[model samples]
Every structure is written in C-alpha cells, then in structure tokens.
Target: MSITVQDMRKGPEGYAWSRFGLPEYTDWMDESLSWKQTCYIGDWSFLWQHRFTGPDALQLISDYTVNNFETFEIGQSKHAIHTNKDGKVIHEGVLTKFGEEDYMVHGRGGYWLSFNLDRGNYNAKVSQEDWFMFQVSGPNAIKVLQALTDSEKLLEAKYMHAVPVTIAGHDVYALRQGMSGEVGFELQGPKEFSEEVYQAVLDAGKPHGIRKMGGRIAMINHLEASYPTIATDYIPAIFDADMADYMDFFLSSMPSFAQPAYIAGSFDGQEPSDYYRSPIELGWAKVVTTQRRGYLGADALAAEKARPHRVLRTLVWHADDVADIQNSLLREGEHYDFMEMPRDQRGYMWADRVEINGQLVGTTTSRGYSYFFRKMLSLATVDVDHAEIGTEVTVVWGAPGHRQKSVRAMVQSAPYKQDRSRGDLHQSTAP
Candidate 1:
C-alpha cells in the first residue's frame, strides 16, 4: 500500500514528538533562557548529511540552489535554499565547502540535491553519512568551546567558517554559525566519537554553567531567531505530481520525525500549494541572487522578488486574549484548543490565520512562549502592506473543526531577538 502526506494528516494531534535522544536535564524555562543568559548544547544528530564530490559537485549544487556560489570558498558555509519550479522553498540547509571539489550539505536540502543528481549528467558523486551534529550556543558559548580545545582556531574562525579542532583526541570540525542569535559553534564529527565528544564538551562546559537543551525547548532559539524549519514552518514543495517519485523515496527513507507533513490551525488553504511560500516570503530574499541563473526556480524567484506579496514579521499575541481562551476551559460550552507553552510538543505545522477587520491578511507559524521575554511570539508571513512594525492584527487560533479564539497580535521585526551570531565572540558577552 502506498502512503501520502494526506494519509498522515488523519488527526489534529499530528505526529509524535520529534526525538533528539535528550530530555530536559533542567527546567525547560531555564533551558529556554540558557542560550541567552549562559550557554547550551543541543543535539542535532538527526539532521541529514549528504556529501557531494568531484568536478561537477559545485555545478550540481549551483544548478538547484538559489545561492550565488561563485565565491563559496573552502572552510566557509552558506545557508542554501532549494526551491521547486514554482519558486516555493522545498528545503534549506547549511552547505559547506570542504575542498576544491568536496562539499557537504546538512538538512533536508541534501535530499533534494540527491534527487536531482541523477536527472542531470553531472560528474558529482553523492554519499550519505550519519554524523553527530551538536550546536553549542549562547553568550558564553565561546568560553565553553575554548575550554574544550587547546587550538586557537576558535579565536580565528570567522562567521560561517569551519575550523578543524581536536576535542577528546578526536578530529572534529567546528563551524562558527549561530542559530540562537548568539555566538555559537556547530560541532561535527564521526558518529563513533559522538558519545566521547559530547561528554567531553559537557565536562568542559560545567564551569560555564552549560545547560543540556532537550527536545522540548530545543527550537525556541529558532523561533526567536526567525529560522524557519521544514515541515514545521512550511510544507516542502515535493507533494506536486511531478515529484511523486522523490516524495515516495523521501517518505520511505527518512525517519518518522523527518517524514511527517501533517498540518493544523486556522490558515485553511484549499490545497497544499496554498501553504507554499517563496523565499521572499520567508525573509530569505537577501540570500537569493539574481546573478545566479538557470537554477531550478531562478525565473520564478526573480519574479517573486520583484513583486513579493507577503513579508515575514514577528507577531506578539495579546496576553489577555490568549488568557481568555485558556480561561474558557475553566468556564462552560466549548473551549479553544489549549495553547502549548514554550511550543507545541507535537511537531505540527500549526499555522493560524492573521486578519484585520475580518479580512485575511497573513498566516502565522512557529508560535511559542519565550520565557525570557515573558510573551507569546510567533512568526507571521503577512501581506506587505500590513507587515510594518506595530501593525495590529488578529490571529485565529485553533485547529480545524475545533472552537477557535480571536487573539490580537502586533507586528514586529522578523527576528524577535537581536541577532548576535555573527558578532565578535572574543569580546565576551558572558559575565
């Protein structure tokens, strides 16, 4: 029997929790604040790693991605975006250039690259590997990393640049990339050394008050940093009929957490494409290069960039309005679906409709409670006319076929938190 994404969207609860193998060793609220006040190491081993090699490796990547790779040098990485023919983002991830013709891509974007590899007559050879990817992030991230390695590479590494370092007698590549909107490093190494390296870093970070971020609050940084995630933020563009074969392979090969396409909430689109978003709508227009031509969706992206309808913004939900929904549970009649604190434990693309005077204007995703800010924040893709700062909007929060609530929200910057990931870590923001 063949299965489709619709087959999986059978319930409002969506799929089970995404497994990262680590539960909260401390309070989730404290863990939420760790990346801001102190530091945290979150496990991202489940991220797909695909390596491409040979003369046509860069060509294969450039042909399908929207990034300008003309100056992508060794030891440097770029946040690459892959889109379908319609310019809708299929997947995005970190693409690192290792050698002259050697490159590796992390996240679902690799699958898209692999899917297109055979379609073209490129000389690239593709290989898949399991890697232990850990992200150590926060204001004190540098101090914690400095304790683990004696190499001065940590001090010399530039933003999005990978430096070779030895930790626990194992060669690990540390990439100076921050997803937490703070100083951070993504450590990558062979899976065999996962336990040793992870433990060693934990021990080294003990003095810096490092927190073990579990699956619960693991994505709070992403929400605050405006990093849109696949499946959770937007449905991949693989559901189209042309990509049926690739979709089947993706479903059969990828893990449960990585495979689900279940969606819920108030933004009722008639079809899957209604939920599709262009890079411009996701606040990634800066990464799209008009200089690069012939990529999968170059023409469509160029067109969208010229006339973008929606822009990304942060929506701050009204406390009293949200409280009323929860308060309804204590009252009578029907109650709105409970708003999960921090974030929904069940990983669903919970999109709510944004409106102004009963007129649809935008859609909100990645809604969560930021303990640090003491407010409920969500990422919204609003019509450009209504996306300005302080623009008041109403968010209809509830799953389909359930009692909904009208929650007032105000538009703010896309990244609710100030981005300091690319800032000088040597200056030390740690107290």
Candidate 2:
C-alpha cells in the first residue's frame, strides 16, 4: 500500500486505514462525542478528488451527469449522480464550480472521470489530485473558522456554498457543508498542509471548546443526515460490459481503490438483480432535466420515468421487534442476526428477494440508529403502494445462519429526521 505523507500526519490523530490510505476516523467516536457536545474537528481526507478543466469542461460535465451544470453559478455547488446505460446509479458526488471551466468532484468513487475521458468527444482535461479534507462541526464551528482567516466573508458564506480562504498562511478551500446535521464547515487543502491546517483550526477553536472527533461520530451523523455514499450502497457503472474497451483500459490504469469493481454487476457470477437504482429512485429526480439536449443514460432514464418501477422511502424498524430479535438470538446462544452498527458491502443487496408476505418489492440500503430522534431508520427502494408515509411493511433483517433474517419494518418519508441540519442551516428561523 502506498501511504502519502498525509497518512502519516493523520494516523497519530486517529484515522482508520482501509484498502485506501486514510479512511474516516471512526475510531475516535468517544472523543468526538465529548467535544461535539461542545465542538469537534473531524478528518475527512479519504474523499477522492477529480478535477475537470478545459474549454468544453462545463459542456462535457453537463452532458455526462444528471444535474444541470449550466444552472450552477461560479463558486456554487450541487449534489449530482451519474447513471449507467441501464439507468442504475454509478457514482454520486458534490460538484463545485470554481471557475468558468474549472470543476471539482468530491466522493469516494473515481471511475466517473475515467468514463468521461473514454467517451472522448469533448476536448477536456481530467486529472485526480491528493488532498486532505477536514471538517469542524457543531455550534462553535463558525467561530473557529472566523478566527483562522482575515476574510470576514467566510463568516457569512451560506450553507452548501464555498469560499477560498487562507488558514495558517496556507491556501484552503472552505465549504459551509455539514454531514453531522449541525452547523459546520469543511476545509480542503494540500496534503502537505494537513497538519498545519488542522492545528490552526484546533487553536482557533480551543477557546470555543473544540474537540477532535473520530470516524464513529461522523458515521453517526451521516446516518442522521441520510447522506448517500458511492461504493457503499451502489457501485459505479464502468464495470458494465457495455462500455468500450478503451474505457476498460483506462479504468485498469487507475489506483486499486479508484478502480471500479464488479461488485453489483452480473460479471461477478451473480444473477442480475434489482439492487441497482436510477437517479429518480434515489431521491435525485430534481437533478434530472430533459429540457436540455441528451446526456448519458438519457434514453433509458426517460423510459424509466414513463414506467417507474420503484420509489425511494425511509423505513423505521419497530424498536421493540428489533430488540426482541437480538434478545432471542442471545437466549439461543447464537450470534446476533445483524450487525449492531452500520455496514457497507461492496455489492448491492438484492431488494426483491428480501421482502415480506412473499411479495418481493424493495431493497434497503442504509440502516442505523437515529440518535437525535431515538429511533432506528433505514433508506429503502420500494414499490409505489408501500412508499406512502406510515405504510406498514416487513424487511428481511439479515441471514438466518449464513443468510439474513427477516424483520418487520414501517414505511415513512424519505428523510426520517424532522429537523434536517441541511435545511436548518439555510432557514431564516433559528434552531
């Protein structure tokens, strides 16, 4: 494994190591809670970075992804998804426009860039960079950022917006985005400057009670926010055979972690299943625009719109029932049926096979405890009838011995959090 200097810098500070260099610092949940109840700093450096630039950059990006890049003003950002020819999601990330032709894509998967390069019609330059991402979140996050730079403008930057600033004499990109469902900002800068930037934020935030958080706390907040991550729920589409040979070659040249795997594809020797999802099924319909000319997967997605098969909905598992399953297994002296914490398998979990009442309908992607709401929540793709709010349904929990066990789950709105921090940060009303 190739470890960058950035890895050494963050390891002592408590970050997890995956196949990729620096995973999120989930090991530091205790420290996060102690400090986040007041203030906390988290390492988010593992997020991959892809830069697209050239005369036709915007046009190429607009044609490649589902979101309308034409609508995004310079210095603004939007969440977007890239679907396959079959209309299944390959990658999802935040697209930030830095200049007329400059854009950065931040997410776990990098095969999307290779897919664009292989399409090869547009004259655009694409490259990947090594950068470290750190986020300071909590009630005191703004105060910490305000003291780091002379740019008073950073203090007023709206949520989901970004501004270039200098921190501890190093150039840093700061975005007012929070995964914790709390008021916060994320800092991205050169890997060489990781320690300095982290120290600067800590120093500035100490007076306001800042504490360093680990990956566990960050994952807890991610569950609360219901944020979708690539490779965790859905695999990128480059692994599909429909792509040209050159595209496959380009993907092979990428780093191991960056390469697309056949986790959810039929090439893995598993039968094709409904674990795949279109952008519309993932609550990203707003980003799909047919008003513009055709883009990748446009035809397939259009057909899907005319005859949609399933819709996305949130599931609230019965607390008592879930607890009872755990208790029963303990009484039988058998291992627990499902993992107590959240898990991300590389392949998609087949939704239809894991249904209740012998009717295969939807697949569940993310499941976790909503600490803020005091309930267990899951994100699932279900048929229209069961997609309504307050609908009762059953979800197969996990495998019986080597297989997943089934459990009863209830249907609810897409977002289980009554008070979404993303919306809370933008509203005129105070929390």
Candidate 3:
C-alpha cells in the first residue's frame, strides 16, 4: 500500500508532500549542511520495490538486467541496469540478492523485469512489497548506527552489503551505501517499525546535529555526487509497442507516472531512440561487460560502445550569470528560470540546451543550487569532444518560446564530492 497518510496530490507548483509530514523540514541551509558536517535522515518509502523468488529467479533477472549475476552472493547488491534490445537503458535501480533464488529490487527497474517475466516462460514469481526506507547519511551517520547495532559486524559492513541492526528493539536491515557520496546506511524493514525506528534514530542522532532532510533538499546530493535519476535524465522505455499493457497497468497503478518529459536540448534528433541513453552514457560504463558471453542488449551495447557519444559530466554555472537570474526577481521584468535551491519541483525533464561557439553540443539536467558547494551546479551529458575538463559551454535557461539568457558553464569531472563511502570503519578482517 502506498504511504497516503498525507495528501500526496501534487501542489499547484508540482510539489508532493513527502512522508516526512512537512514539505520543508528545518531549512534548506541546515539540511544541506547535514549531509556534510552533521547528518540527515530522509524517508525514501516512496520508491517502488518488487521482490522476486522462485526456482528461476536468478535466470529471470539475468535475462532482463545488464548486471553479471554469475558472482552474485547473499548480502551483496549491485546498481543493476535494465535496457532494451537496442541497448537503450529502460530503467536502473539497486538490486539485492538475499537467498540464491530470492531478490529485492528498489526503483522502476521492475517494469522491465515484470514485462519480461510475463511474456516469457519463466517460473519466477514476482511480488511487490512495501518498505519504509530511511536514508541516514553524512560524516557522522555511522555514529548512530554504532550505538543501535549490537553486532560490530553491522558497523563494519562493507559497501553495498546489508547487515541486520537492532534499532528501537527491532532488527532492521541496514544497507551500507551512499547517496551523498559519504558514509551512510539505508535502514529499511517493516513499516510497523518505521515510526519506532525513526524516532529512535532521531533521538540517537541528536548529539550529531541530526537534521530532518526533506525531499527538496535530499536531491541536491545527486547533483554534486553525479547520481543520474530516472525521469530527470532519461525517459523510461514505455513507448515501445510490447510495453502497451505495462503502461496501462503502470499508469492505472500510479496516475502520477504519466508525467511528460520536456526535451529542450541541442541534440536535434527525431526518433524516440534519440531521447534514450545507454548504460555507459550514465557513467555506468564499468558495469557493462562485453567480455561476458551475452545478456539483453549486450551485443547492441557492444556496438554502441564502438561509437562516439555523449558522456556524463558536471557543469559549474558562471557566478555572475547565476546571480543575474536571482537579481532579476528583484526587478520588475520577467526573469531567467528561477534556480530553486536544492531542487526543482517541476515535473518535466527541464533539460536546458548547451552550446559552444553558437553550435548546439549537449544537454544539461538536474539543475539546482547546492548550498554545500555554495555554487549552482548541474549534471550534464555532452558529446565526448565537449566533455573535456575546463571545456566552456553556454546553457540556455528558461522555458521555450521565451527569450532565454545564456548562462556560461564549464565542464568538470563528475563526483565533485570526495568519496568517503568506501572508507573502512574498523580494522580490516583481511589477512
């Protein structure tokens, strides 16, 4: 069942109230700082999850996703990518392996998997499960986990590994992962313990300046940390004919899934595939294995890999030009697109056109003001030629049909934040 306690109906401005009760908790400033100096906790129960269990579960997932499951083991998780036969990414998410035939996936990745299982003669049974996930992250996140967990093993869990932790007299699974590119644990379990665990964690985190992070400020990590999101960057694979029934079920299940994408980019292509992105284009190049025998889209991905295309990078907006847009609100005239702090609540893709030398080159998405960095940053996918460090590009800001102002930007390497996610908590168990 969906978390419908609060009226989730989108506000006039395209904002939805998160399960956190309020839209904005504390302020964007303190919440933004919580991910750096202190810690922040946010509820991510909104994400859809599907559990697969059966004799053919592994094989069913192997044929649907791009992850190499030959070496997959219990307690291990991977950022699995699902793609069409043409190698275009359909959806991607975190896939966790529990038993040999048991798996849990978080995100829209289940769409492709469900589509395949329904059409194919697989013995796997797919059951959707609701989980209340709380993302507790920052430099001091482990501090709270240390106090709650009885086992030192939970505190020392490896990256992407899930360990059981006792919090508020309940055993919840804490996945050692990072959304802010820092030391963090995503504590998730039954919804009954959600309220109890949430309070326990908040009380435990009080000394560390633990702040309640709302949905608005929670997305800023993706900008600086370079985590590409669904709908915000690439369109899901719903246009294909085979997915007609799935779209019907998808839209009927969640009416908000029908949000349209706004494509305002310089890559003027006509086909639907033109709007699609490959696994490699989203900085997941390492996950695609050409050396392996075969998987869905493997051959096509290999072919696409042999060609030139756009890659993910960070674009730092010009200081004066960004200020000019903000200062416009003080004046009496129409202003450049208002850069909302932390995130943009608008539904559309909001992809801004990027150009160099008056020639269209790339597209930028996930535009936001990162208070952590004290600068306006956006994640962009530009042609490999324009992805060089310090390459200058101009971003066309504002909705279409409006006289847009040029915001100068420079290309920088993604993962602008120093990665502390894989750091060791205690002494190594290695010999």
Task: Name the top TM-score candidate.
Answer: 1
Whole-model lDDT per candidate: 0.86, 0.63, 0.76
By lDDT, who's the top model here? 1
**Model 1: runs farther than 4 Å from truth?**
1-8, 11-14, 19-21, 255-259, 429-431
What C-alpha lDDT does candidate 3 achieve relative to the native structure? 0.76
Model 2, position 60: C-alpha lDDT score: 71
When 1 and 2 are scored with lDDT, the better candidate is 1
Model 3 lDDT per residue over 1-431, tens place:
22111111233234532222336788877788888888888888877889999999888888878777768879898999988778888888999988888999988877668777888899999998888899998878887767677648766688898887788898889998988888888998878779999999999899878999876776677777889887677766555666567666565555563332334433344444556678878888888867764677888887766774888999999999988878888988776667666666654345778899888788888788888788888888899988999999999887665657898999998877777777766521122
Q: Candidate 2 regions off by >4 Å?
A: 1-39, 108-110, 207-209, 244-273, 303-307, 333-338, 342-356, 400-404, 419-431
Sorting all predicted structures by lDDT, with the top scorer first, yields 1, 3, 2
Q: Candidate 2's residue-wise lDDT over 174-236, tens digit each?
A: 887867666777898779989999999888987877877644445455545556555434444
